[model samples]
Target chain A: SQTIHQWPATLVQPVGSPLSLECTVEGTSNPNLYWYRQAAGRGLQLLFYSVGIGQISSEVPQNLSASRPQDRQFILSSKKLLLSDSGFYLCAWSVRGPTEAFFGQGTRLTVV
Target chain B: GESVGLHLPTLSVQEGDNSIINCAYSNSASDYFIWYKQESGKGPQFIIDIRSNMDKRQGQRVTVLLNKTVKHLSLQIAATQPGDSAVYFCADSYSGSARQLTFGSGTQLTVLP
Candidate 1:
């Protein structure tokens, strides 16, 4: 069985502060990783997705960025956080082929 | 560009009654669809999925119907229970790129006792 882990389950950051969220998947290799943000009462917005190491496709232009450092490790970062950046961030992983994704517990980020 | 949307923002159903949630997508090239359920403060959970080639698929007390011509999809829940109350979202994916999923706004289902 594969498990996804995300850290700092809850985060409180000051405005303009740097932000870093990490996601790791165990028991799977070369999986597709994605970063999504869901605002209060809104739908999930795809922020970034990576097919492999150093390869990322961003869906919307924003202050956040994502990176795939290792095959099973993905990181979402921001140089400066904005008030609008606060939301529930989710990390998901899927096999290389057509398979349903497995999501992590998710991180609740609040930028004050 | 592909866009998925739900028909309603909220739905209330009595307990034990059947519930149906509807969705529509604008992308004709999409060949796969999935339904997800999310509770408060939790990530979306995969409920069921259907391939575009198939019109309907059934799972444990859940059925997903796909209408390619109308670009619509629906999820049917039998004997709706209180635990089934949550926000449901419909996602679509293209044939070639099956990894990325485009999600809809989601419909909140409330099961009344």
Candidate 2:
């Protein structure tokens, strides 16, 4: 079975501080990775997605950026965080085609 | 542009009752649809999915219905339980090489015990 893992399940960062969130998937190779954010009581907003290593597509323009360092390792980062950046960040993986995505336990980021 | 939207913002149902959540999409080229459930502070979990070729698909106690003519989709949960309380989101994907999914606002389902 495949499993996705995200670190710093909860994070509190100061405004203008740098941020980094990591996601790794085990038992799968060359999977499509995605980064999503959800505001309080709102639905998910796609931030970025990657088809392969070093290849990322931004769905929305924002302060956040995503990178695929390895086949199953994805990272979301920001040089300087903003108050609006506070939200629940999720990482997901899917097969090549249009398949159902498997998600990891999200990281709740609070930018104060 | 492609987009997915839900008809309701919230739904309240009693335990053991049947629950239905409705969604609508704007892209006629959409060929795949999915329903996801998210608990508080957790990532969205895949519940059920239906392709455009099929009108209905069942999984365990959940069912997904797709209507391409009306660009509408629905999710039905049988014997709703307290554990089923969560936010439900509908997603749509168009037919193309890049299979990107567009998600809806979502409907928060509250199951009262």
Candidate 3:
């Protein structure tokens, strides 16, 4: 079975501070990775997705960026944090083919 | 997708009654759809999925009905339970981009006990 692991379940960062959230997949290779941000009581907004290593597709222009360094390792980063950047960040992975995507526990970031 | 922050459409159903959630998409090329359930402070979980090839699919206690002509989908849950109260999301994907799912605005289901 495949499972996704995400770090820093919760974080409190100051304004203009850097942010780094990591997600790793186990028992799967070359999986499609995606990063999404969901505001309180709002639908999810796709931030970035990667089909392969070193390839990232950004959905919406924002203060955040994503990168896939390894086959099953994806990272979401930001040079400076904004008050609006705080939300529930989720990491998900699906197989190359048609299948259900599994999500991690997610990171609750609060920018004060 | 449009944002409905803090004011998502909600459904209130009595326990033991059936519940139906509806979703609509504008993409005609989408050939796959999926339904997910999200609880408070947690990520969305896969509930069920259906392919464009089929109009309907059944799960343990859930059924997804798809209408390609109208580009709409519906999820029916039998015997609504208190635990079934959550936010339901629908996602659509095309043929070539099977893994990149574009999500629909979610509906909050509130099971009345």
Regions of model 3 farther than 4 Å from truth: B1-8
**Index of the highest-lDDT prediction:** 1
Worst 10 residues of 1 chain B by lDDT: B93-102
Error of 1 at A61 (Å): 1.0
**Tens-digit per-residue lDDT, A1-112, candidate 1:** 8899998799999999999999999998889999999888778888998988999999999999999989999999999999999999999999875557778889999999
Whole-structure CA lDDT of model 1: 0.91
Writing each residue's lDDT as its tens digit, candidate 2 over A79-101 gives 99999999999999999887888
Q: What TM-score, to 2 decimals, does candidate 1 have?
A: 0.97
C-alpha RMSD (angstroms) for model 3: 2.3
lDDT per residue as tens, model 2, B1-113: 46688999999999999999999999888898999999887889999888899999999999998888999999999999999999999998876726677889999999998
Candidate 2 RMSD computed on C-alpha atoms after optimal superposition onto the true structure: 1.1
* lDDT against true structure, model 3: 0.88
Ranking by DockQ: 2, 1, 3
What interface RMSD, in Å and to 1 decimal, does model 1 have? 1.5
